[model samples]
Target: MIGGASAYDGTNCKAPGNCWEPKPGYPDKVAGSKYDPKHDPKEINKQSESIKAMEARNAQRVANFKKTGTFVYDVSKIPAAN
Candidate 1:
């Protein structure tokens, strides 16, 4: 009617030109590496670093709150811990 029959054909429709196709078992690959998902050491390290930074920031906020009865909403606003 409006667009065409392919528009209403759902997933069964075929593209006209060179269309992008998803790789098989793409979900199993997070970083697109052969040793991805199972052996993602780099990603794990990054997450651990992030967690450590968050923990340190929270500790700083808590110490600041204990000293002065105001909770810091932003980590950047928190004073440097000495």
Candidate 2:
């Protein structure tokens, strides 16, 4: 790599690391993270929706990286905190 920069993982994130690692308790059905069918319905449902959204976003980032070698950020895409 030029300037000795390490290979960028999907979204310019450092490769060979757990940058893609999900939160401990998250059950990502798409990313194949731990999934407990017996998990509480309320918690699972809530987590599932948010997890799915995040997975979609990250997948897009990875795809963009594959196409352009980096993720192009647009701050307007993010929702502001309350």
Highest TM-score scorer: 1
lDDT of 1 by residue, 1-82 (tens): 5676544323332466535444566553357666455766897799899999999888888989998899997978987767
The best candidate by lDDT is 1
Worst-scoring 10-residue span by lDDT in model 2? 73-82
Q: So what's the TM-score on candidate 2?
A: 0.36
TM per model? 0.47, 0.36
Clashes of 1: 0
Tens digits of per-residue lDDT for model 2, 5-72: 66655443346454665455665353444354456678869978999988877776666667668565
